[model samples]
Target: MPRGKARTAATARKPRAPNLPAPFVNGTILKDLRKKEWKLGDEVGKGGFGLIYLAAEDVDSPVAQTAEHVIKIEPHSNGPLFCELHFYQRVSKPEMINAWANSRKLKYLGVPKYITHGNHTRGNENFRFLVMPRFGTDLQKIFEGCGKQFSKETVLALGLRMVDALEYLHENGYVHADIKASNILLGFDNKQEQQDQVYLVDYGLVLKYSPDGSHKEYKEDPRKAHDGTIEFTSTDAHKGVAPSRRGDMEILAFCMLQWLCGKLPWEDKLLDKNYVADSKIRYMEDIPALMRACFSKGESHGEISKFLTLILKLGYEEKPDYNKYKTLFKDGLKKLGVKDEWKLHLPVAGTSAKKSVKRKSEEASECSTPKKKVRGTPKVATTSGSLQHTPKPAAKPRQGTPQTARGTPQRARGRGTPQTARGRGTPRTGTPRATASRASIKSPMKGDSVNSPQTIKSPAKVQTVKSPVKSPSKGNNSKPSTRRKVKRSRAKKVDAWVQTSPR
Candidate 1:
């Protein structure tokens, strides 16, 4: 990891968490690389499974060289360890999607190049493992750096590719159950490619599908226990339904749309919290129609809501025969009446999408390495002392209200929140939370066809009341005012509240 207080301070402000091994120190694994140790270098990252070390070296003398490669580790399991192993072996299959993107089959599936995989055993326990060429940082880090919003052209460009990738996997026979910002990697745009690329990373929960597109349990262990990152898991995934193309699409939509709306579908305050809470665990198709209805007003979302509805429909309904809706999806964007924006080709950029591009050849020599520079080693990040994780405080629980830990209310809205309609059930103190006025936002800036005037730069503003503050007294109080309000006459009200344990 890079050394400095800069990274330390940055991580503290970011609420970032890097998985640390419980039993083993990374130094032990560094020792195993011995001659290769000089080439590998120190630990770049560590996770629940194991450690990811940088290994930059020459073909002849691997250990004693500059940074060259990366090794990801899954430390030994303490007890039953079937799911993790099954998942790793399944997705890491030489002929699987990941492998196809590598040298074996020669498809640029936008995945990293695979290295080698192995594990170490201690006493009665066995540790499963794998390795890959580590490059620039993953998207989670990039998104944190970029913050909650992305420009339209940037989003459209990225959105089309990710969806296309998901569609491709579904067509082949696999489901990448875990799709989150962390699993997407971003760095140099290969010089030969159109621009910077966002390759899919971390196939931790990837599983295979039968020829009929149905799931076949892995012989290693298929108890329906294995799933994916909770933040990205689809309703079907949460319900123990086997991962499917639809589920994968749901995850893809979640990953892309989160950048736009900055809220989860099931967490919307527009509906009864009870329904969402219960429904959040069902399949996408099982989501209540009312939830879809809430999105009926495209005006409220500025066209973004319509795209999200499509994603929700894709997640819940049957996969649209791409053949049937390919042009229709394109037309929907056109119908939005967005002007000056180029049609981002669904499979690639419009140019690549329309042209008949040949698949990459299998010979590694035939294909030149992308000219884009690979990301350098990341500064090692461990939990810092200044930052603390906190959940929302429970709202003063109403006599009949259910409460989440911490005193914050769940889905409580009204005059001051999204859930409440003009103080109806809202507490006296729960005044509607004010939001950014459209007038205050910088008017649409002119740009290339890729970027449009209606661009979102941060997570859509969401308001959550941590605790109602007593209006400050003019004479008896000495505490400085803690509330802040910025009003704009033209924008719609957006409510968002974040919980943080004071530093």
Candidate 2:
């Protein structure tokens, strides 16, 4: 090597701390990368694999100043951004987005639209960046802003929206391995429809399990189990099995519970994956009780219980009945006598009108009041209040309303549609509770039109391994510390797939 050239190469390398990459300088111009000129702004977020920056088109360019976007950049040498770039090229296409949205009868899909992506060179290093529309805040931040917990109705509404997004992704041959509140962002545009939307972002950990339109065979790969966020990962994830439709629903259920209760049962025991796993088992074993602890007593709680129980019953490889799950939330709204729409309208910014809904307890009489039969056509009484039914035999006396432990009234039926009245009966207040003290705690390749191939970087040091599912405890189980050590030893034998980065 030439002396002068070698010295220049040595000088270009920055002294980086272990595991952290070289930081990208703000205001740095990435030249010839995209059609339009862009200059970087402040760092909006940082993660294990890359940094996210606010980007604006240069002043002299033809674009409007109001058009702001977010750019996610990782080392040009290697990262998951390369994988994501290809996904956006296919899934985020304008026509494809429109098709999915129209099929679902939604104003917009809950996914970030890809703008442009390319690589920028700086001295001896290259950095890859992807530009996407900027969004408001994540559900995590909004949860904090609205107080630690969300109302039961609000949580159900959010769950319904998330299911829509996940269903779209699953149908499109992808699985969102990481499903949590932090990954969900609300839109902030001036358009009302956009403002009412929530998007699932950060596809770095996503996997294309059904690349060719069939779900991959489920096999236990201990190394791959529990490859996502610890607290909300699916049981399949814990077992080192590949994530599927059921896994996504399980994770979403955890998010809903946390949003309602303000914390998860295993939030404090994050370090012990086995403990967390066992706790989750106990949670699923008694879904109704968990719902009671988290959600307020009412139709909302009953509906949420049904939704989760159904999710729990799903097979590891089974396709879910999306409409049935959606109907659970819709039926809850009907029973509560609220609007059929998922979103509750907050009064206009300056208005003093308070938002409220009738409680299930208050609706007891209304639900119990039987309809009177008429011999002739029903009365057409309109403007003025009067009996609507033609006279026949007077209706029987109202039936007694059964109440939940928390005093929420429920409806009873001899038989009804879909048997929706199953869990709304009297609550079992004296059921023995399980042990509440238990603790514990993507993919590859192909194609592409926009993203170019890059070399893989050296693996970063292994951090904590998350449990996707807690194995059911047997007669005598090993201690958590001992079990963790065994898992760690096994992990050392097989290299864990790197998460790469975030959305």
Candidate 3:
């Protein structure tokens, strides 16, 4: 782990109850959270780190009738508010808040607007709290409402907006170490335009990637691996390196991939860090296979593959070309013939929905058919944890002692049976010879004669023997002789034959 960069897992430790106050009751007066005292209403949310309450201005305040806000209270000793405070303060700066928003034509950069922050003592407990404008439910809630997956168009739009948010953060030298659907909040309004507006919240895991204008170098530390959410964390993060610009983009790629596919490759291995890392590497090595595994065939997944590839190519200290990615999604929308509109009714019959219908119909047809009964010898059960099986003895020959392949009567051999031929003239009649299994057979020598019983040959052995042809001297530049060419051709045929033959 880098010096001064070690972070405990979010919510790993809870504040001692004696040092933290119990949940505030409705109408409890909170002092200094805003211009005047604010009254706590109902408990809105609770998390591993803290509790959130619906807060409104106290009756005496001039803006008492204003819209309600949310107050997040945490134990002063341990909570995410300290880290989040820094991010909110930086982003809320007048010149920085909308620096890129206008140019991008986004309604707003998706950060929760900061209201106020302060510390308070409730009876024996001292606590830290932050007040911010309370928005609608997070994307996780919406994802559940819409089923587990989002359409490609919806995911693309979300990706573009998140890229912008990350760009703003990177330009200011910060990175959102935690970027997941639950941290993203949908716009509060019921209107379609507002519904499409997405905000990136939860900055408790935020870290400065390039503090003092110097980018953080990549470092590999096993202890630090699995720093963030296991399912979507970047490979660099898995190596325990401090999160960087590339790490942010990599996390975003995971998010978009999950939203499109309904699950991530590492979701099943959430508790196993090493397995998740290995699975990520394997999937990345074959992105096309990854797409096919996650999505139905014939879907336009090339764009996502390209997007993920771009992130994979980025170096730890390198800044991403945000405009290039933004343009990529923009051009994708145009190619899909989607109009220049961010808010519109989604088609009831989408690609994913259609594929879902097809799958259900196929499943129904399969269920409607009856399965055929298989009649044959039952398979033998093997002992668990052992690969070897004891061979069952062959059945004796039927009826009146038939003649063996070697012209011997079956009964002539005492306490012995006939052995099968090895693609040869005759079978042996005696105690079975200890012939090598075909899989264990070695290549026959050139002088060995297959017709003779002593020189039984296996199908073909693929030994990677070097060609006997010798190159002419470098300075001579002479062509090979006819004899050498003939030898080379023969060698090629033997090589091909060896590879094609059954083991």
How many pairs of residues collide in each model?
A: 38, 16, 0
Local accuracy by lDDT, each model: 0.43, 0.59, 0.64
After superposition, the stretches of candidate 3 with alpha carbons farther than 4 Å from their true spots are: 1-21, 33-35, 60-67, 189-193, 344-503
Worst 10 residues of 2 by lDDT: 434-443
Off by over 4 Å in 1: 1-39, 57-66, 78-107, 121-126, 187-195, 211-227, 265-503
How would you encode candidate 2's per-residue C-alpha lDDT over 261-365 as one tens digit per residue? 777767888977666766676777788767665655443466667777998888766888888877887776666566845473322331221222234545765
Q: Give RMSD (Å) of candidate 3 vs. truth.
A: 19.2
TM-score of each: 0.46, 0.61, 0.64
Candidate 2 segments whose C-alpha is farther than 4 A from its true place:
1-21, 31-35, 59-67, 191-195, 292-300, 340-503
Best by TM-score: 3
Order of models, best lDDT first: 3, 2, 1
lDDT of 1 by residue, 128-223 (tens): 445565555565554544444444444554555566556655655666788777776653333222235566766655666564555553221122
Judged by lDDT, which candidate is best? 3
Error of 1 at 313 (Å): 5.7
**Per-residue lDDT value at 152 in model 3:** 70
